[model samples]
Target: MTHMSMSYLSLIVVTMVIGMGASWYVNRQINKYLHVPASMRVTGAQMAEMMLAANGVHGVQVYRGGPQQDHFDPRNNSITLDPDAFGGTSITAIATACHEAGHAIQFAQGYAPMKIRGALVPAVNFASNAWVFLLMFGIFMQLSGLTTLAIVMYAVVVLFQLVTLPVEFDASRRGLAYLKTQGISQAEQGGAYSVLRACALTYVAAALTSILQLLWLLQSRDE
Candidate 1:
């Protein structure tokens, strides 16, 4: 195999390792706190509704999503939680629900980063899927212009991931702060923080992997 092929293969392996490790850590944290009931003992849905009301964020609905699916949709002003998080009173559930609630607050308050990230979604969706195909075809056809364009497209995906970091970290911060103010025990807060932190690492891992992949693409061009 060519040196270029070997280098790319090595990067792929490294990125895969990062992704897998992040996934494992997140799952481990989830399992560790999954059954540890919160002192509040409020259901995840109840916690989310209370958070929304406390923040004066009205008209946003909380709904149950599929397994492992938890997110706040700004488009519809809704928070969706999976079964475990929707009704369970565990630390994991409360943390996840409150974290998503933080996003709702961001939306209501017009957080600049969140707004920018939302604006980029459509273009990022298109670019992320198209870039790899464009890069491969460009290289096969010896078209430098197409290859450069492909790199630019992938850069958008990387930018989105980087923008995501602050948004996520801020959400976790808000969630934790709210927990503290609400008198959640310090030990419970620690467990909740662990869950949120592990989840945030997944985004960091993804961003790092994208950056390395983009760098590899750039390096291969000069080779």
Candidate 2:
């Protein structure tokens, strides 16, 4: 194999390692904090509702979802949490539920980055699904223009991932800030922060992997 091909394989291996490490760390954090009780003693669902109310956000519903399904949906103005997060009073529950509530707050407040990320969702979705085929076909057919177009499409995906970082970090910040306001014990607050930060790392890993892949694609095309 040529040096370029070896470098490409190395990039893939590095991306996979980073992605797996991030996933494992986040899961470990979640499980570790899941046993630590929060002082407030409120379920994750209630915490989410309270956070939304504190932010003067109304008309949003909170639902219980399956495991690892916690998220805030802008389209329906709803927050959904997994069974543990929706009902448990553990630090993990508090952190995750409020983090999602932070997203609801962003939607209500029209946070600029959040809005921009939302707007890019459709294009990113299409690009993510279509780019691989386009690139493969372009390369096989020796069409420079098509390959360039494919790269451009893939870039949209990378852009969306980049924009996602701010939205995610800001949400975690909001959640932690609210936890502080509630006078949570330092230990509990620290636990909450750990969970949120670990979650954020997954996004960071994803963005870095996408960036590396984009760079590799550009380099390959150039050669």
**Model 1 Cα lDDT, one tens digit per residue, 1-223:** 3998899889989999999999999999999999999999999999988888888889989999999999998879999999999999999999999999999999999999999999999999999899999998998999999999999999999999999999999999998988898898889999999999999999999999999999988888777
lDDT digits (tens) for residues 133-177 of candidate 2:
999999899999999999999999999999999999999999999
In model 2, the runs with Cα more than 4 Å from the true position are: none
lDDT of each: 0.94, 0.95
Each model's total of backbone clashes: 0, 0
Residue 167's lDDT in candidate 1: 98
Q: Which ten residues in a row have the lowest lDDT in candidate 1?
A: 1-10
Look at candidate 2 and tell me the lDDT of residue 92.
Answer: 100
Worst 10 residues of 2 by lDDT: 1-10
Model 2 lDDT, residue 95, Cα:
99
TM-score for each model: 0.98, 0.98
Q: Residue 186 in candidate 2 has what lDDT?
A: 92
